[model samples]
Target: MKKDSTMKRVLKLLKPYTGFIILSLIFALGTVISTLMIPVLEGRAVDHIIGKGKVDFSGLLFVLKEIAAVAAVTFFCQLFMNLINNHITYSVAKTLRQRAFERLLRVPVKVIDSESHGDIASRIVTDADSFTDGLLLGFTQLFTGIMTIAGTIIFMIRIRFTIALIVIAATPVSLLIAKFISGRTYRYFTQQSKDRGDLTEYIDERISLEDLVSQLGAGELSKEEFVKKNNKLTDSATKATFYSSLTNPSTRFVNAVIYAVVGVVGAFLAVAGSISVGELTSFLGYAREYARPFNEITGVITEMQNAMACAARIFEIIDQDQVEDCDGEFDGEVKGAVDMEHVDFSYVPEKPLITDLNVKVNPGEKVAIVGPTGAGKTTLINLLMRFYDVNAGSVKVDGRDIRTVSRNALRSRFGMVLQETFLFSGTIRDNLTLGKPDATDEEIIEASKAAHAHEFIRKLPDGYDTVLSPSGTLSQGQKQLLCIARLMLALPPMLILDEATSSIDTRTEMKIQDAFNKMMKGRTTFVVAHRLQTIRDADMILYMENGHVLEQGNHKELLAKNGYYAKLYRSQFMS
Candidate 1:
């Protein structure tokens, strides 16, 4: 999006806080009026002391008191304005962050899977922070600066119109300089934000896989890649800073010229007896006040440019196409009969993966799917779960199209345990009760025992209350066991086990396999496994290759046929 468009969207976010903004503007005006009074009062006091001998003491004393009162008013007004600015800054930032996160949850899973996770995180956290900083500066300085300039001009024109005209004529020169310099910095700041995201993504990716990097002895290589990204970020930041930094000094130079010109003209006017020394004094002060906002605004423009760039990145996520779900709920109990009719799907449209694939499995049947890597094994499971919709056909459960049902209702019926395990940073009880929050203690124990996790849980320092993180002390097999125990607690009518025992040892695998056999008795089960021995007793075995079911039959039948499944079966058993 363009800068102007991004700014308009940001303004919409602040619409709810218009009351605070109006109050701030009110105080800003009060501050400017009080500040303008000081110079006028000070000029009056100077006139009161006429060549030391002919002094107007009462007039001088009264002007000094007025100056003191106005100064106090200015301080209080400024203090209140600053408080309002801070409130507006952080509140808008919080709103943006909350909206960005809500969008993340609503958007399609493919949208998230396609983007860099670290970059998305940066936009929500780091970019929001930068935007707030710029916003705060704009609120505190930009508004006040503009007001001060206007007030100073009115005061100066009252004192002497000619001098005010000179200052006004030079005003556009300072503004043109600021605009020219600030315009060039936007692209640089944009590049800087992107580079920072790239660096963050690289760091998060490398750190998350530190164990693999160490095992492969690629630590040095990883460091080198990190350094490359870091250096690139540094270059972009330095260049952006270099360009933005020019605005302040450039405007300051033009302001100083205006200040000098005002002083020279005021002195000539004073000599000609057209204006008093007191009025000249006030005019010089007004000239300084008028020029000051130009400098401050130029600096604010620099930060505003950076803020707009970050905001554009944040809005990109918020504006993504959300995953659409129907309002339909299941009409009756789900019986786990699943069928895929002429289903076609591909991650990328140019390269088709699963095409016109068909599958059917009745309720209470144990179906095993075996395939090599990249043979669309996991992709099939994804289709069934409705993580991605089929491009050409329908996936049906209990003879109704799955897409017609709400995603939450459809997913809640299946219990799945995949190869990779994820444990939140909470007590084991919290993680176990996620799917069934109202599960009783007895039920938790029973599920744990069934998954062979109870013995290990009992050995922990706090049993089920022990906290666990993804990088906690638990081993891979232990975490996988906990995942199984979680599914057991839920006990959905259908099950999908995708190498669920891949992390466990042979002994544990045997025990878990027995437990799974008992669990699979009444429910329809789909098992995707690389180890052929684990699925020998399945009622039907599907051998898939390149998204097509090459052969499917029970162990005896496929063996008799001497097909692909038999060849795969012999490799594992006879090798």
Candidate 2:
């Protein structure tokens, strides 16, 4: 992205606080003016003491009191300026975080799946941290530095145009140093931010899959990989720091040159009749005041580069195209009939998952889809839910093209229990009632009983109110049962069990099968199962192979046909 774009986007976020910024600028102007006037007053006091060739006690006292009053006003103005600047900084940070989070909610599932959770999270957390820190310092330095520079130059020209030329000549040296250093380091800083995000993602993945890594004896390998990523981040950060470090000392050297030129030239001018001793003293003071902040400005420049990099990442996510709007508005009740006509899709367009697939189901039929791993089983579920759109053809519900239906309305009819169960960090009651927000306690208990989860839930310390985290101590089967119970309460007109009973033992599977039988009574159901036992009684069984419906019939009919279904069934149970 262009640097201007990044700058403009950040400024756009700050645009709403124009009035506040103006007020800050006013305060800042007062502080700078008050601060500059002090040296002038001090110079005049020096002139008075020397011109008299004796200490003028009362005159000195009045000068001292005037300087104190100006200093006091400068202090208050500086305080108010910082307060306003801090408010803008923190306000921008808060608003940026909110917008990014809201975009996270509205972003497509495809985008979410493509990006790691940690990278997105870093944009919200890590990037925001740098942004808040950098911006707080950036705006504060920028306003004060600009005002001080302009004010000093104007005052310096009035005092001595020749000395003023020296400061002006040295000014670009500081700017050029800042520019050159920032240019060299911006890319490294950007890379460092990305590498940091990758590290966060890696850590989260490692922790979540700790048991699997250890069980597979890949712990050392994973650690090596982590080290590699960590080194990349460290290297990028080192390079950024190294380049940015050059700015301050280099600019401070130019600052020293400016001071030297002013001193040497001012001494001659003071000796000759060209400038007064007091005027020369004030000019030197103004030069120091003007040049000192380049040191601070250079520091701000380093941080600004980092902040701009972070802001770019944030804008990248915020600027992503949102999910396609599901057009048309319909409140018609879904009767649960679904169809896929010549449907085709691929997560990657060059590698197809499903092609020319056609299927039909009546309003309340029990349908089972049996397939091997990677046979596009889950992809079918994604399509049906419109979590993704088909690259070609269409999936229809109740003879209406789903593409024409609003996503929320179409998805409202489906309640799914997947092989991988996910529970949010919340009370059991919260997870259970997600599908039916108004589900009463009695209804929740009944649903839990139907899914065989109530007995264990009641035995827990808090029963339905037991809070659960994603990494909570709940057993795999227990979590699955809770997921089932949650869906049972939902009781959508259509039901899906995608290897939902994988973790359950034979005895518990049988019990859940009974519950599934009860749950499937009034709903149009779809089951994707590896265990043949769960779907033996499905009204229609589809045997899929390599994304195609190779054969399909009732269980007995498929077995009678002596096809893949019968072979798959025997492979699991006949031994």
Candidate 3:
């Protein structure tokens, strides 16, 4: 959606808070009315003293008591309304944040890959937080300020209409100045948000690759790049701050001019005997009271516009198209037959990653895809998982198109173990039972034993309850073993092991291969690996080059053929 329309949509989310807004305005009206009474009562006290030789002490005391009572009531009303506004605001912010996070979870993997992790994180945290602040404080202040200004205007006119006209005349001029400054502030704020997202992306990229950066001696270059992004963010923030800060002092200057004009005109009317001394004094007090609301109104206008910019940014993310889930009833089970027929796929439109790909795996068969780097091995797995749809042709399991099945149901049928393993900050048991949440402690330990992880976990200080902090603790091979244990607990009907054993030492690899053989006994499995000896006994071996199948056969037959597969096997194992 366009930024303006997105902002309007965000405002619509606040419609449920209208009742609280009305109550706040009502409180503001009451407060403004009560404040007007003080000046009138003062004028009356002065008149009573001047009219008679003696002061009316009883009348004076009664007026003072009424003023105190009104003051106390007004204070409570403001406090109560503020508390309500805060509650309403917090509820709305919570709802918005929850929706944003849920949407992120449901979005397609392709959509996630298209944007940087840091950029998405910034939107969820920084942008949404700014939107919350603007929605609550900005909207409440704006509504109340408008009410106060309107109520003050009516009372000031009642006191002395001629002096009231001078204050009213300043309204248009104040609005014009506010409008001019708001345009600049809004543009600067938008730029600032974009720049901040860029800076966050840069930092995330650098930190994740810190070890590689140090190895390459690129520290100086990384620092220079970071400095450039930081400077851009600083410049944009400075411009936005400068423009937004102009609001207060500019409005104050205009108020000062209005005050001088009203004073001169009010004195002239008093001198001509058209107005009493008490009336003129009350009129000046009304003028000052009138300025207070107008100043508030101006400040609210400035703040709301600034908040609108933030709202626009937050809505932009919410407005983007998320992956549409295929509609169906699913029971999270599937027959293991797999097929890819005449499939063509691409991450970019102009460059095809896989072309005219045709492959099939019978139920309970073990197949290995052997390929060099960038030969579309992972892309094929991604397509089978429906992370990205094939540009042409179809992928099917048990004669049913994968796209026809709901994503969750289709994904639940398969387990995956990748080369690079990630262990979240938690107990070893917590990581093991992630997929099979309902599994018993016995089941978890059994799976861990099958993956050769239970013995090592038992050796830890806290055994299975040992907590692993992300920054310290586990070695790379140990993390891989934990992930394998997680996949074991899942026990899906089909599995994909993409270089799963490559990270471990040769001795550990042989141990894990024994576990893998046991796990694949009756399940369909797709193994993608660079090692020639890993898949020497597979049911079939597919040698792929530039997305095409170069050879296909059992390992011994392929080596006997003296073709591309033979050449590759000789280069590695026969060396």
Candidate 4:
């Protein structure tokens, strides 16, 4: 999108704060009005002493009193405006942050996977911060500069038209300089923001893969790559700052030249008797007044350009297409039956993954899906949860199509335990309540016990109240157990274990399996695992290969058939 259009959209986000914005404008106008009175009073005082050749003490005192009054009012106006502006800006930042986070929740899983974590984080934090700063300070300055210039010009013309004309004529030169620099600055800053996002993504990827890099002895190579990215970011930022910094100084220089010219002309006119000394003094004062705001106008333009660059990035995320949820109401509870007919799917259209596949699970049935790596095991679970819709065919829950039910209702029906566990930076109790926010302390302990995590949790100094940061104080298995405890508390009608025991030791896996057996009663279960031993007791087993079902039946039936399932079992058991 063009820069102007992007900025317009950002300004639209400020609609909710219109009251504060109006208050700011009123204060800004008051400030300018008060400032204008200072020069008028000074010019009058000069006229009384120099032109009249007499001093009126009372008149002098009156002018000084007026100047003092204007000064006081101006200060108060600025103070009030600043206070309101800060509040409005904070509100705007909060709204944008919430919208971005909610978008993440609604976006398709594929969309989230396609973007790097660091880039997304930068958009949320860095870009949003920039937008807030710009909207608050930039808007205030821009509005004040324009209003001051307008009011100052009117007053200058009323005092002396020729002098006003000179100032007006010089205005275009300053604008031209500002306009040229602002364009370049805006483009460079946009590039800088993009580079920053890239750098952030690179750092995030490396940090997350630190152990892998160490094991492969690629630390030096990674460091070199990081340096390269870092240098590019530095270069981009320098260029952006160079252009933006030039604008203010360049504006000031042009205004200085204009000031010299205006002063010389006004002095010549006063000596030649074309204008009085008092008028000339006032004109010169107005000229400087005019120049100051013009200088400010140029600076505001540069800042606005930079702010818009940030806003474009923030709005890009906000404007991304969101995943479509089911439109119909689904207030009733869901049965555990799930059926997929001739489902075909692919992350990219050019490379198909799951094709022409059909699967069905009866209510309260235990079904195990055994497949090799990249055989679409997790993809099936994602589809069932409506994280991504199938390219072809339909998924039905109970008797209704899944598409006819709201996403919240569909997802709320199942409890999922992924291989990689993620815990927030919070207390153990806080993390457990995520699955069921209203679960009581007693219920939380019960669920933890069921997942075999209660004993270990009790060993902690504060147990449920122990504070935990994201990067501190938990083993991988312990985190997984915490997630399991969460799932147990949810007590959904259906359960999905997607390689849930892949990270645990054999003994712990056996214990978790025993816990799973107890939890599986009266629940529809779908177990996706690489370990054949884990699924041997399932009521039904489906061996999948290249999106096709190669074998299906119980362990004994598949072994007697001596098909793909039997071969997979023999290979694992024989080892």
How high is the CA lDDT of each candidate model?
A: 0.92, 0.89, 0.80, 0.85
**Pairs that clash in candidate 2:** none
Q: Candidate 2: lDDT of 413?
A: 84
| Candidate 4 local lDDT, residue 206 | 87
How do the residues 85-174 of candidate 4 rate in per-residue lDDT, one tens digit apiece?
A: 889877888888888888888777787888887888988899878778777766667777888788889988897788788888888988
Model 1, 271-301: lDDT tens per residue? Answer: 9999999988888888888888888899899
Tens digits of per-residue lDDT, candidate 2, 1-575, equal 77689999898999999999999999989999998998798888787776545878788889889999999999999999999999999999999989888887777899999998999999899999898999999878888888998899999999988889888987887898889888888898899999999999999999999999999999989989999999999999999999999999999998998899899999998898798888988998898899877888899999999999998898888887887776665557777888999998989888888889999888888999987888877888899988899989989888888889778877778999999998999999999999999999999999999889999999999999999989998899999999999998998999888988998878988888888887888789999988888788888898887788888799999999999999999999997
After TM-score superposition, the amount by which residue 412's alpha carbon in candidate 1 deviates from its true location, in angstroms, is 0.9
Q: Determine which window of 10 residues in candidate 1 has minimal summed lDDT.
A: 327-336
Positional deviation of 249 in candidate 2, in angstroms?
Answer: 1.1
Per-prediction TM-score: 0.96, 0.95, 0.93, 0.94
* Leading candidate by lDDT: 1
RMSD of each: 1.7, 2.1, 2.4, 2.3
Name the top TM-score candidate.
1
Q: Candidates sorted by TM-score, descending order?
A: 1, 2, 4, 3
